[model samples]
Target: MAPKVTYSDLVIIGAGPAGLMAAAWASRLGLNARILDDKVDRVQTGRADGLHVRTLEILDSFGLANAINEKAYQLREICSWVRAARLPLRAGYADCDKNPDPEDDSKIKRTERVRAKEEEHGRFCQLGIHQGFIEQNFIDFLRREGRLNVERNTATKSLQLDEALMSDHAAYPICLRIGRSTVTMNGDTADQGWRSPQEEIIKARYLVGADGGHSWTRDQVGIRLEGGKTKVHFGVVDIVPITDFPDIRISCSIHSTKTGSTMTFPREDRLVRFYVQLAETGSEGDDFDTSKVTPEMITEKASKILSPYKLSYKHCNWWSVYTVGQQCAPSFSKDGRVFLVGDAVHTHSPTMGAGMNVSMQDSYNLVWKLGQVIKGIAKPDILDTYNAERQSVAQTLIEMDREMCDFYEKGAGSDAHNYDEFYERFRTFLSGVGVEYGPNALVVPAREDGSRDSRSCTDLDKSRQTRGFSRRSLASKIPIGQRLPSFLVLNHSEANIVHVHSVLPADGRWRLLVLAGDISKASQMARLRILCERMDAPSSFLRTYTPEGDKVDSVIEVVTIHAAPRHKVELFSLPELLRPFDPKLGYDYWKCFANNNAGEEGDFDDAYAKWGVDKDEGCLIVIRPDQHVSLVCGLQEVEEVEQFFNTILVPQQRRKATAAACE
Candidate 1:
């Protein structure tokens, strides 16, 4: 008989980037999640190394970006090259010159020179950190949260999906077999441990395959990965070098025969990573002795690439040789209950530098939807969007890497040798500016203009008409479909400045921020109280001044814009809104309003300057808890918001029909 145990929710197959992120997000959403990996220790050595800007922003959500930035080797710029001798061909930052201006007085003009310098250097550069360091930080975060349990040195031998244990509301039921024992657990549980195959009969409502390219989960689900693999064998060697190549530079060069390519990137702790592509031709199944790749061979290869520049390596830290390949699964999910993410879903050549970022993002996109489904706020079919959204991203990444390989390996004399064009494409891809969701994606509506009065009045005309005498502060009005800007505020008693996120409940509840002036207005306050009660959302009221003779609800935090002498409620002035809200402040403010520069030199001020506003007045904007805008509506349309949520949360009749067909 199989021993059985159950769980609270969620079982992730791998503890790599995708699985780790899934666990972290699940914990943040108040779910009990367990992670299992075959390795005895967290991946502490060689892996992917580049972190893109957008990935940095996502990490910011978890408050890890700043920490990463501090420790990471900032590749703020890159020098291009034709060969070892003519290399470091300085071209101005590609992105800086992309957006040019004519007017001298424009904000764009003020930063143009700086932009030029960065262009001559490189703009929007990626950071180079060992994948091991990133994994360590994530592991530390999970440990600090005290919510994640990682099972090490444990391999999953087999899995069984139980049809009877499955629910009409869930996609599937899974029974997993470990080494010897079977322990039953649902999608939600903190029951993470290593058990024998005999104890493996434990059941789960859902399963995520983040197990990587050689994914056991993918095989268990019978998903075939379809893509051609490359014959190139690349060796990576990390060493603490005693050399004079600027530690800040990432040098990539092609050897004389163009048979091999060598690239170097700086790492923390006086270390550098060297990647050398070995030239060998044989049948597809030919196995080269990768064990022969040593520190001396790597140094010899580096010296050849650097040539006149002279390079050497002494203190070796870690070294490994592995073949490079490209492959991606046709689908990201199978049977609704089993989902594939990260390398399990897609694998590509390392040339494009997108592996780690893409893997983490896959988890990011899926976690929120999964949370909604588990909480019963969204239907099971909502999970279908994950594959639809991420598959395209994976395909694009594969294509980009293929192009990069052609550029690097085929020599500049080839037909694909348009270095300038290739560089432009690289900039655009790395900028994260072009990533757009499909029509089926959820989009937030942004304001149409940057005018201060766009929020309060039904139309801009009325607000403009009364501008001088009764101009409403932007603070007292909330824009539709955009995230509320955060600001620093003193407690209503004028004691301390608290960050807005500090006041938020850690359990992932939605909030309604009310920018009201006088709580003494019994009718308005009553309406707000009723709205809060109906929405089951928390409300915080802010005002410029406290009414001299009115009683306010002490339970709700009441912040004043003016001076005060209390400790409970927060206070902030209008000027604070123009400044970036530090997270240490108790007020949650949007970063869009702080500065127009996106790490670029010039400020290309546009209507979307503060949250990409692009619609007329009297419109209501509803944003997802993740801060992505979901719906835009016309004035006073609470029912529309409710309808939108219902449509998204509940599986449509058509989706239900499809699921029935698949079953």
Candidate 2:
């Protein structure tokens, strides 16, 4: 028979972090997706493992944070060590207090020990878990939801896209020819298990190239990675130590005057990861011969850096070699149909522990938009914003990676080396919380009039425009394009305290929050009522865009937070639109919250003051599905809310017709 034919709403090549994230988002959004990888099985061990604060926040939204917290090792502190002798005058490093002999400069000793910057605030800071465990979580979630499963042992032979059909929303414009392993021997290895292959064909509405740094899909799309690699190479090993290294159980940065530098990561299951700087050998330009390196070699380098403290491993879990490099794609998408994410779009040293975090975030940002367009809930042009937004992030990531590589290579030798200052500068970005998208189809520019500007949204170099009504000042702490900062509040019905973001799950629905200041006052309550009247009207965007016969809060979820005592406001007293009732689900008592200072938790002022919104004049805020703030407006600016949705959402009447016709 001819090659078996299949179809998918989205097809992703690669089952790594990025591809798995894309699959997770697609499954969550109810999209028909197919994820394929040539590897026969899941990642067994040794890859991207560090999870940043924002990434943990994302997992919490999905109800997976607790599980991760149980299994992963928490990294709450970092310690730095250097030569005990009189060192160069680096601002961050003071002389080692633990040095036995003041004049002995030959031994390594502790220089500084400080709390992890990420632990200063936020619900979670940093975690050390194996990449395989993370991937398995995504797999388990997909399987539990009865969604798509990854197709492994499948190799893509070629790909083709019909240019004319690219603009057609209903067309499966991208086509791929692939092969799967058909036979395996009883004792064959992972690579030798496959003998022959059966061919297959897949046609998809959209395609994602999340393969890796050497992405075949990226090459097929004619995109070139722009940048060069650094000459510095590093040997990485994960092992259970057998020696008495002082900070073996803690994350540390050790710099030696003669032996080079080593970074230590305390991981789950008592395993420690050591990244040891390798000395140059007989290697060609730009290429470090990893074949000449081994776990023994890596351990030797690490032992040299440790000095007086003995270091060896009873068991070695994994080992590899890598060169520090920086390269990024000029753009992330081809014709808005074929997109690249993760390492496919950017490549850098793994020193920052950002490769997997940034890569997974790219898919987290893109797939929701794709689901909206595919389901006829949003305009097709919104897909263009994916490139405009993520490419800028990729460029920033490349720059940050370059800086990290430079520090690791040269920080030990330079007198001006200040790791403390360097760490402080990029702490927020490194935690994955400082990322901000510019004005685009999805993010409204910070202007008073709520108007769209004709300037290039993709240019990250331009300073943000600060003109017109100045929405940024309304909530001085909440930047419009960044993730919404979380605070605690009391549930109006149960008087139970909860984090504000726990209510804003990753369900692909826009959030409209009404911060009605001091609702006990007649004026504030009156303003909230008027806004509710507009939201409940027949012509409102909530009704106009939500499909016929669907729940009112399906597309846009309305949540109310009042600056009134929890006991004063009954959940049922809120407008019907805010607490919509259903025959099966009853009224949504969880939608309304009160800023009552319950449990002496001190979260009431945190909600009002930290948000920078006055209790007397409440403001309205719009949050994207990914928890990023899109718009901030006055409570009475109902028209502005409607206008913002009009630019993106399709009317329910037209959306249903389009979806039916496509079917």
The candidate that wins on lDDT is 2
What's the TM for model 1? 0.69
Q: For residues 177-211, what per-residue lDDT tens digits would candidate 2 score against the true structure?
A: 88776434332122333333377889999999999
Where in model 2 is the C-alpha error above 4 Å? Answer: 84-102, 183-197, 281-284, 412-414, 448-470, 596-605, 657-663
TM-score of each: 0.69, 0.93
Top TM-score: which candidate number?
A: 2
Deviation in angstroms for 322 in model 2? Answer: 0.6
Off by over 4 Å in 1: 84-125, 164-167, 170-172, 180-198, 244-248, 251-259, 280-289, 411-420, 431-433, 441-620, 625-627, 633-640, 650-663
Q: What is the lDDT of residue 321 in candidate 2?
A: 91
Clashing pairs in 2: 85-105, 448-469
The alpha-carbon deviation from the true structure for residue 382 of candidate 1, after best TM-score superposition, in angstroms, is: 1.1
